[model samples]
Target chain A: MIAPFKTSYLQDMALTKTPLAKASYAGLLIALAAIPLVTGEFYVGELGGLFIFAIAGVGLMLLTGYTGLVSLGHAAFLGIGAYAHAIMLAQGVPFLVSLPLAGLITAAFGIAIGVPTLRMSGLYLAISTLAFGSIIGTVLQKWDKLTGGFDGFPVRPPTILGMKVQGAIGTYYTSLIVLVLVIWVALNILRAPLGRAMVAIRDSEISAQSMGINLAVTKSIAFGISAGITGLAGGLYAHYVRHLAPDSFDILLSIQLVTIVFIGGLGSMHGAIFGAVFMRLLPQAIAMVRDDLPFGLGRTPGLEPSLFGLILVLVIMFEPGGINGRWVKLKHWCKAFPLHRRAASRRQKSYAKSERLR
Target chain B: MESLVGLLQLVINGAATGCIYGLIALGFVLIYKATEMVNFAQGEIMMLGGFAAYTFVGKFGMNYWVGSGLAILATAAFGYLLDAVVLRRVIGQPQFAVVMLTLGLAFIFRAGAGIAWGYDSVAFVTPFTNSIVKFGSGVVLGADNLSIIFGTLVLCGVLYLFFSRTRLGIAMQASSQNQLAAYYMGIPVRRVFSLIWAISAGVAAVAAILLVPVQMVDVNSGIVGFKAFAAAVLGGFGSIPGALVGGVVVGVVEQLAGFYLPTGFQEVTSNIVLLAVLILRPQGLFGQVIRKRV
Candidate 1:
């Protein structure tokens, strides 16, 4: 009876309002697909760069946003995946087999770390992950034969489906396809019982345990799943960049991933995509301005990180929920129109309280 | 006989290095006690402290003692300003917010230092008497090592006295233990926090000064701060003596592991040791083990 009743027109525009909203999602997908056609090699490569980070950001959202595990060593899993892919390639394994194997290996490593560290909470867990990243990078640098040491190893592009997969377009297509598939899997996982358990733990681990969730098993599995996704991204990144170095997978990269996920708004898949694009493109956009602007200071090489830090500080201080959150407010305003002003006034107090808690 | 001598030398050197780690970890512990937050910029603060001293002595042609003292003072002031401006607003925020803020601070400080001092590593002259002392079976220790060990010991002794015997230190300790109760008791919680930042910065400067003699100074020197953080966790969070033991354990483990482990594992010895400590006994050697009521 409720499904057959007519809904108010205003309610239809909100996310998850109806099946019609999802049907319109196809339009957005089409627009993304058409981007490569109009964009040149360099620009497509740039978008591909965003996709690489988006893949990892998705998993981090699962861990930090949904699973309540703050990982500061996610780059280690990425490194593992990249190195695993490289090692497999050197052994002449096919790309199809190598990528999945890399994910599996990273998942196992994650489980190994998670099982031992399941008892830790909050800051301890974060630092442990940071340690993992540091150790992994250091080992990669020292293991000369396997990782090619400090000089790093050059990766050959994977050949697939009788086509010699190479260059910007090939890599972009591969990345896009993989990202879409991974996202579908992530959404499915999020809707499952395990996903609800992860969220329950995030909201209140004690409560989750009280309700009969096996805390240790759930935490480890979440970690393993997240690591596996991160590994997939890393494998793609190595192939696309065609180079792997210890410096490429530093603690800073892990920190960056966490920051991007935060800036996009945690626990939202759309937020992950939004965050990935913003982070990857921000520096590039700044560099573009530097090239165009007449200022001498703009030409400096190391300014990117400083600028990134400044932007991050500003975002954290002023807009904790990030761009996606802003979009949500904007959409709400557009739909509410004349009533928006009164609604926003009532929201301010509650919003401030929530922000403080976060 | 030669191997025994080698082991002795390694232990002495490790102890000296551990002293520096302990000093840095002390900075971390102090800040955590005051703010209940990790200062990721602790290492960068140490780097800036070293660079400040370097600039004063090398560029300004000042006496070493005067330059070092001035640099320490400057770093302490900087630390206070950092807390006042950035950390104050996030007082009740989640731990991740503080972590991110410190991470950002670290990048800013590191990049700013890179610009000011240039990226290349530079040599720093220690003010200590640069003499090497030889012991039995060809074992040797440097004067700089002696200074570091002595300096850290003296600092710890002074801190112990200050915390236990002085009004301000005791009040600060009370504030860290429970801010609400401390406030009710008429302790100025905010003032104690600012003082904690100042002291942590001062200690970091001392660590930086001591460390310069052992390794060449650069932007990366701040990484020693991260190692110190690991040392702090290994010893047990909020435990002063534990920080000391943890630092020494990490330093010795690193030195010995580098020597004994296959060459591939040498560079990672510090991190591996930290991960092992975290996985096994995270409460640390001197830390009071805690169990959740739930």
Candidate 2:
């Protein structure tokens, strides 16, 4: 809770506000890098999956959390990216060239979907995006010549400089590096004026427009950037799985991405990571404990989805700000510790009067 | 001559299925009118209703019509309970939260149905036998399809009368228009919302009853609800008659596309129509253009 004083302009704009914060981040990075060394192959693969989801989560956080656009079709963009990369790789293109090209192709699709949709807001936008996603899924299935239809197609392992990245270890390290690069880029974007504009638009589109922010361009760019990042994650996922299917990128996946973004805490960088890790690891944790339950619940085929839905509902109801919000609150509480006041612990309720009027 | 007969048969089949979609779309429209939140669980509720009816008839050996009526009542009660227990807590939250909650509810409903129904398609017994009715020039209609269309018409007429002539329905309408004013004017807004949810679920149950005879009831039956959602959107989300019209259009289009177009386009035809409508005429055919106040 103690405010850090910045002595210089350089200090003010630094990634971490204090030396302690910087050290913690460095320590966290070291721990992440050391994960594969300590964990078994299965755990390492799960961590890789976690990183891939985190990357996509960050992209969605940009659009939904910061840009205030709720899209239910993000998985479609991911599918597009996955398909694009698979096709490019099939055509004898190298991994390096195909990856970024996949991102660009997905970004173009994002812009194409966004330009017409940017005018609509809230429920309308959500429905349109849902429709858009369904269409992508349909196209992926029907366009069998390109997508291989329902049976799906296998993806070749990504190779760099004539060396193939093999097994969970290589995939984990590659994903970690990609995740770091993505986080760095995202942080830079968040610190820039573009990020501020997105936040402004989220707060009040009318006010943002009145302040000379180009609503159309800013919204489209946000979609493009978000989709591009998500597409990159999709490409990584496809390469990691070595297989692709239309069903893998369905509405359920889109909902899962949204859940991660919300559960991680909206509009925060660390929140996205927290959410991805929580969501990805949750099913495994549930599976581990399923057999030990008192009831005969272990035999149930759909317990995981039921539990997930219950958790989502509970999180939204009790902690709207998600894990990041809870973490900040805990941090504040610990800082106040013995001298903690009830007033200080009370959470702020942000109910808008306008919503009631509408 | 055979192709023309096949086309007529497809249209007839499409119209029958469209009636079910229209009925489910009515559920979406009613809830949206009452609470501005799109209940993604609407489809799941229909699926659950179908399963409930299936259990009543298939397991218990109850008469078809009696089982369906009981199922409708039970589902309505479930809907009321859902509103009271879960949705009531998150009433004032953002639209996204509400929508997500409904989606979560959907997941729960789907999972619950899967657990209860064992993830298998079950035959739903109807009062009418599956006798084929031959018409002019070899154009044929199944008895179940005829019943589906007739059932839809009866449900529509009843709903129309209830909404137009009843005091409770008038109050519900008042609450939808302006909740605060309705509350101020001595209307029980909370109860009205609960009733709306109940009615929506009941309508969905009817749709399920009608649909079950044609297609076997299964866990994946909820998938059809998305097409119903598309129909609702195409009809201008909150419009009652629009839902019916949109449902028919979507159903016909889907049938035509599945028969005429390359394989798999049928599954996505509604979504394609929905997207086109959203982009070209977001207000829908019957919906008024919504203006945001800065």
Candidate 3:
């Protein structure tokens, strides 16, 4: 992965360091594009769900991973976006317009929630977000006229350029396009000075402030952008699913999104994609092998959740760096094959470890 | 006079429910005091305890008291094992990771309970039958409500005595204040940590037992833990007495909101109070203000 010496500043600041990396990335994009054509209808739908989750995962990574803000209310924002998009579409608004508008509305809500809670950090902030999420959930259930109450409401499939985006393939492409655009935006943000500011704040708010970074502005902006991105994903999800229920975006979904970020590898943009794909495919994999297993374990009501919980615990205990961390290590080890030094191939300390009790 | 009586009834019911919240909040405070880690699984632990008691009394045909006692002991053992096996390894990990781990554990516990005891809601049998006791001109209290209030009071008093007068409790407090220093002084810090988890789990079991008698036992009963969490935060996360006061406050506010406001406000009332307290007064009523240091 090491790159040749760059003669110019532009070359040094390039997204991909080497031509091999660039070619591989291009190949990945083409492979992703061809997935809908080659895969079955069922898999196309799964990929749609994957892309939606990836969008949300990337959003969460920006806040929790880079900005060091833990939010248990992400699903609430998603709920807001889903409802907003649905409402707008019902009113004859275009899909493209409704998507960004839903994002903007969710961003406003995010800022409103963030402004009050951002002053606090760690567990307190997490609890506050949890409270906010529950409150939003309650609102979604009670506001019957707007949200259709517990029964939920129908979401009309989105149309593009006067043609209906029909079926699983259509939705998959729409989600894929959105996912690609979001990834691009996210990558650019990370490369920018603002991303560095966020990382600095995450590392040490006090030191970041001493360095003249506005804590309030940076944190609030992060919250808004994160919520906006998650909201867009929600908009996409609503159209894809063609239905909306308050229960669909509960605290469990929020937990799942966070799990995606963590299992993929926190603070890495690519981790979101890897985590989302793995998590989305996991239940399907289980379902495929469920009948073969002895004792009918897969038929249990909470089996999937229990498995997810076990995975989360295992990941945190053994691989705090997650799947991406393992990938990086594997690459390093492979590069130094035959003389691979475990110590030398270890990942740099990027994440903040908790302080031991005095 | 009838309206006044209705209000009093609501207040009484609120207090009873609040006591249950206080019991759960007390678990949060105990663990936080010892380790500064919020056990997100506290509610799920409560739910499992209730299921355990149900299985003992209903399925095994055991006496109510015996079943309750067994449930508490079992949950305590589970808690100890949880801390010793899983949580001990995560001692110096980030707060976010620990919190998420507890959340994951909560999911596992809830799912396990659901699988073991079907998702159906079953009436929990208590020794005392449901009876209404009239007081003064119009105030009437359910026997169950009175028992819950009194039981919580007794538990709190016992806990207070344990922390103040017992040797092991004092040792736990010493370890919580300074683990390394306590270790230097020959206290078993790791053992203390496990004991705290056990005590917290046991308290959660008591809350669940009391709760199941009032309503019914179901897999989703752990949702009450979220309200208790709010109560813990509202009262001051690490303060024992604050948990009680906070629980009462949240319960009363929730009942009043449900009574006076539009329908469905009750569900969100505790969260609203939680958010308000967290934003307006992060230190809480009893919590000491934490000053930031460079």
DockQ of candidate 3 against the true complex: 0.51
When sorted by lDDT, best at the front, the candidate numbers are: 3, 2, 1
Q: Which of 2 and 3 is ahead in lDDT?
A: 3
Please list the residue runs of candidate 3 whose C-alpha ends up more than 4 Å from where it truly belongs after superposition.
A1-13, A345-358, B292-294
Instruction: Mark the regions of model 1 whose C-alpha exceeds 4 Å error after superposition.
Output: A1-20, A90-92, A154-156, A291-296, A341-358, B122-124, B134-139, B292-294
Error of 3 at A14 (Å): 3.8
Model 2, range B83-178, lDDT digits (tens) per residue?
Answer: 888888776677777877888888988888887788889876586657778787677799888888898889889988888899998999999988
lDDT of 3: 0.87
- Which pairs clash inside model 3? none
Best-performing candidate as measured by lDDT: 3
Cα-based lDDT for every prediction: 0.81, 0.86, 0.87
> After superposition on all CA atoms, how large is the RMSD of candidate 3?
2.8
Candidate with top DockQ is: 3
For each candidate, the DockQ is 0.38, 0.48, 0.51
lDDT of candidate model 2 versus the reference:
0.86
